[model samples]
Target: MQINKDRDWEALYLANDTFWDHGEASPGLVDYL
Candidate 1:
């Protein structure tokens, strides 16, 4: 996983500006977990 320190992107995501949030665990991640 990559981490971004850009404040603009961080703020946007924190403020719900992102378009994708499945509200569930990803299948691949769930499998790994």
Candidate 2:
């Protein structure tokens, strides 16, 4: 359960970061890949 919670948080953070990478803050969308 603890590991799962950590994974969830990591996923959320990753998603948020990915979103930001392509969000209005960027001049244009950039694929992390």
Instruction: Give all candidate RMSDs, comma-separated.
Output: 4.8, 8.2
**lDDT for model 1, on a 0 to 1 scale?**
0.71
Candidate 2 lDDT over 1-33, as tens digits, reads 234443566666666844334444443434432
Candidate 1 lDDT over residue span 1-33, tens digit each: 245575477677688776557678889999999
Number of clashing residue pairs in every model? Answer: 0, 0
Ten contiguous residues with the weakest lDDT in model 2: 24-33
TM-score of 1: 0.40
Q: Considering every candidate listed, which one attains the maximal lDDT?
A: 1
What are the TM-scores, per candidate, against the unseen true structure? 0.40, 0.28
Give me the candidate number with maximum TM-score: 1
lDDT of 1 at 8: 74
